[model samples]
Target: MFRLAAVVAAVTVMATAVVAQTDVVAERKSVMRESGKYFYGALPRMLRGEAPYDQATVDAAFTAFADSAKKIPGLYPESSKNAPRTSDYSASPKIWENKADFEAKVAAYGKSIEAARPKATSLDGLKEAHALVRAGCDSCHDSYRVRH
Candidate 1:
């Protein structure tokens, strides 16, 4: 009876941990998808003159980028390091392996967003600042996002 109880307790604990990890992974994915609207959506087209220049869209893009930068570092808890990968996107194990470096990269990304936020007032201004912002994203993604 004692052994059965222990087994049940162990299973419960394992299930709880799995739930926590799954929650964090889902939250991170949702955040990424929200911000991707700007990166992969309207912002790029506006920058390239493929879409009309709307101040609101530019402002929203930078705002989302800045907000996501702040939220992103916190989203990658140790519990999430082992989450199953998806063919589309998943946190790279490299993020946990070099946690400090990954966080520093996130900090740099935040700085880039701040630097670009002011410049995003106009299409031309946004164009000028876009490269630095993109570089920040590339630096992290190239090393810390798994797309397989």
Candidate 2:
């Protein structure tokens, strides 16, 4: 009976660990999705050419873009071995398949946004910056993300 109880306890502990790991993965995926939304959703608004493309808007959008980029490397799973079989994930295994290429694009994106930082002092300046930043988004999404 004692042996049986020990076996059951071990099984329970193993099950709990698996559940905890899955929860962590799910949480990470959720955060990655949110970051993608902020990065992509802001682009259309910036492109509208109607919003006050002032310093504040530029600062906010650029800050958000930078934050989102920082999260990208973390969000990408180390391998496709554990990737979800089916879900709303816009990211593709191609990202991991060509990890170096994907990472390079992400780095270029950060550089483009950083370059726009000093030019965002006024509406016209912000508009120009918006264009540059939008281009970066287009570049990455074109290569890495799938529309759903």
Candidate 3:
């Protein structure tokens, strides 16, 4: 009776752990998707001269970009072999397959946006900043993420 009880308890614990891990992966993927939407949607508006490039707007967008970049590393850690299950996650296994290159690209994107933050003042300046930031995102997406 004691051995049977222990086995059941262990199985339950393992089941719970698997569910928890699945939830974590789902949550991370959600974050990535939301961030991508904001980058792709809001950025073009600012770049095309449709919207004014005030400090407040530029600051807000850049903050979002920076925050999103910071989260990328944490979302796909080394231990998980499976790709995160979420909509449009074209983040190829190659991202983790060549871990060093992935990390370097992510880091470079962060640095480019950080450098652009101060230079963005007027519309032209903001356009330049947008281009720099978008270039980073474009490079990463072209290499790792698949387009829908």
Candidate 4:
């Protein structure tokens, strides 16, 4: 009876860990998608003059990027590295192997957002800042993302 109880408890713990890890992966993907909406959608149109520059929209995008920078490192706990469920992109195991470098890139991204937010008030200013911000993203992705 004791052995059976121990087995049941172990299974329950494993199941819970799996569920938690999956949730982390989903949350990480959702955060990235939020930033993608701005990057792949309205922001570029505004930059190219295809859409009118809207301060509120720009502000919202910066806010989303800032929030993502803060949350991303935490979402990548070791357990979530091998979560059974993932999106088209998975975090490279390099993130765990070189955690410091991965986190430094995220920190740089946050700094870029902070420096860029004020400049975003004008079209040209936003364009210049956008390059800096995009560089931060590319730096991290180049090292840390696996394209599925």
Candidate 4 has a TM-score of 0.95
Per-residue lDDT of model 1, residues 1-101, tens digit only? 99999999999999999998888888878887777888878888987789998988777778788888989988999988888764398888888889999
| lDDT (C-alpha) at residue 77 in model 4 | 96
Stretches of candidate 3 off by over 4 Å are none
Best by lDDT: 4
Off by over 4 Å in 1: none
lDDT of each: 0.85, 0.68, 0.75, 0.89
lDDT per residue (tens digit) for residues 50-140 in model 3: 6655577667777778887888888766544564455655457677788888889989999999988887887777778877887888888
Candidate 4 residue-pair clash tally: 0
Better of 1 and 2 by lDDT: 1
Which ranges of candidate 4 are over 4 A from the true structure? none
Candidate with better lDDT, 3 vs 4:
4
Models sorted by TM-score, best on top:
4, 1, 3, 2
- Cα deviation in Å at residue 145, candidate 2? 0.7
Leading candidate by TM-score: 4
lDDT of 4 by residue, 1-148 (tens): 9999999999999999999998898898999899989977878999889999898999999999999999998999988777764567988889999999998999999998888888888899889878878988899989998888
Per-residue error at 131 for model 1, in Å?
1.7
What TM-score, over all chains together, does every model reach? 0.91, 0.67, 0.78, 0.95
